[model samples]
Target: MGALAQLLPLVRSARRDQDQSVLSAALQAFLDFGIKRTSMVEVARRGGLSLATLYRRFSSKSDLIQAVGLQQTREFIEGVDAAVQQQIDRDAGAEAQIVELFVAFLDGLRGNRLLDRLLDTEPEIVLPYLTTKGAPVIELGRDYLAEFVTRLQAEGKLPAYDPLPVAEMVARTALSLALTPQTVIPLDDDIAVRKYARDHVAVSFRVPVTDS
Candidate 1:
């Protein structure tokens, strides 16, 4: 079975913008005092709500964190989808859209307060989530990339090989690049990053099609 079959099924949370403010407050709490140090009370205080109100919404700290994660995943996917659509509207080429895949990911990740703060101050805390405990997030990325790959292959921009493995590679690499600060890839340089993505990461997903 391919990775897509192993992909986690994403369900849109019933909680809408009303609870998003609470999630944002919780995220701020995590940013201010790290995940371990942040508490439900702090989230409630930051959100300007009573502790009972907070607990009424999120049963526990664990529940709150999971909600925050689900919300973040939605935001990340939405941002990437818009970027891809913008690229297409501009009549960008296949290579350009492929470049946008990696480009849009890291670009969206840039200046993410929680992510940057966590990596800078508490690598030990977040590294595991990005690596070992990463199946949930990775599966989400895998599904998105796999869908994109299937479309590209249908358009004859990619080979007829399976899209799941290719998507997994791209997804995993994209996540790794986002989390890890040290790399020869030169992410600090936007122009260089796009060039590297177009020439390297994008190319790696496409296999040679032989005359059968």
Candidate 2:
């Protein structure tokens, strides 16, 4: 199996998140059978949990799926945040960092067995979370990027500007591209994604924005 096919290491650096604990079993079951085929009972059994206990936590399978989407969104943010930071340390510019986040995320999603399975086998179940009803996941990424912009500002990497809108732009663009793969942009091709990010996305960070 390629590295991408491996289960994403849910624990990254020193971040201890409960989403990993709450959703690992569901992730595994979904990985094994895709969300449509995996029942709540199977999820409970895989976790050595009772159906009642599972219901107490998630209320329903749709609820569990929502939690999983939230987990995937948060993990995606933190995971690529670290990648961008690594690029910064390497003296990589904003464009390179953006490319790192963009490609890393899409590549990770491609390798994400559970999510990939959902896209392949059950689009109706998962598409809403990535699209029309995607506010929860998209908003999570936007908020994380908002806080992340502050850190970049402190490092003198970005000028003073409202972080929320900028963060939302990047978050929405990245997530949207991942969901809609059939573009002029060949997202599967890392070289193309890097070029796209450099030309279109990273330009914002290249120039300083003065407060109006």
Candidate 3:
């Protein structure tokens, strides 16, 4: 059998444990089956957990999904922040570093299939906190963008401008692009998505986009 087939039983056994392992299993099930197919009873059964115990841990499906979302969001923020710091420490060229960071950020976003499903199927779950709560995930992103802009501003690599508004615009723009990708009208193929991200950063810093 293939490696994945060989690992299936091991994966099941690992998930049978009653600790965070079970929760992880439940979350994975939800991601695989989606919200509509993933029910509380199914989650409990997959996790080898009792329905009562699942309820004790998570009062409802929404609560469990929220917990999973928050956990993934925190992890993503930390990973992206670390990647940014690493790129800065390497003293890579500004455009290259920005591209690397944005790609890493997009990888994180794509990995969170559950979050994507929530965005598509249940925007109500995330919209309120993303806007009104202005919680850690959003703030971390803003701070990262603001810092990148300020760095460029200090080095005179870009035009002088308030980073807050620019960061907000970039964040809002990115969010919109991610949540509602342009399907009706196709984007220009000359510039790929990664290039688009790099171009946005270059424009924000007022840097020329010519080959280095």
Candidate 4:
């Protein structure tokens, strides 16, 4: 199991009512004022706790940020899982399902107002969380996709290759498109973006054509 798969249970078990309130307040403050400007004192006040209590829960701003990011990542994974299941239920082919999975992931990111705002105005605050300390989230996503790919292989939809490497490629490609779409292709239209992913995924993972 990856680090994220291990941490998910811990994250679930560690959440108390007080901790939830603190994290909620801290996330709101960060969204409102950006990470650098959001102080622990303000978080405490917003959470209706004393500075000492807040500090006891989260020793510093970075700790609180990590907690918030982890929670968000957990939610994102859940949402993506649901979206992928829905697409599978639609009886789409394996390749189309993969494309839909990424489309749903992209849509989830686009729908998050706070994340979008941070990316727009305070990208610096968000970039490090994704680039420097983002292994947990990336691993979580990769593991989930790996499981999906394994299932596809069992259904004979994809070839019986190692799923982990392919899952990693899918995760990395999705993240790249989400973060730096302009570097890859124009994403001005949703249909075009989905087509692009579909084409790329098909070409990358398609079965070999052998002459009879």
Best by lDDT: 4
Query: Looking at model 3, how many pairs of residues clash?
Result: 0
Kindly list the per-residue Cα lDDT of model 4 for residues 1-212, writing each as its tens digit: 24444445555445888888888898899888888899999999999999998887666677778778777766787888888777666355677777777778887776776677788888988887777777766776788888887887777777888888877887777777667756655456678878886767655655333200
**Candidate 1 lDDT, 62-110, residue by residue in tens:** 5676566656766787789898788665344457677777778888777
Clashing pairs in 1: none
Worst 10-residue lDDT window, candidate 4:
203-212
When 3 and 4 are scored with lDDT, the better candidate is 4
Which lDDT tens digits does candidate 3 get at residues 108-205?
Answer: 66566766776787677666545554343454466667887788667655567788877766666555555666643223342375577666655665
lDDT of 4: 0.74
Ranking by TM-score: 4, 2, 1, 3
Query: Which portions of model 2 miss their true places by more than 4 Å?
Result: 1-22, 90-95, 186-192, 206-212
Instruction: Name the TM-score of candidate 4.
Output: 0.80
TM-score of each: 0.78, 0.79, 0.58, 0.80
Clashes of 1: 0
| lDDT of every predicted structure (CA atoms) | 0.72, 0.68, 0.61, 0.74
Better of 1 and 3 by lDDT: 1
**Displacement of the residue 169 alpha carbon in candidate 3, Å:** 3.7
How many residue-pair clashes does candidate 2 contain?
0
User: Given candidate 1, what's the lDDT at residue 195?
Assistant: 78
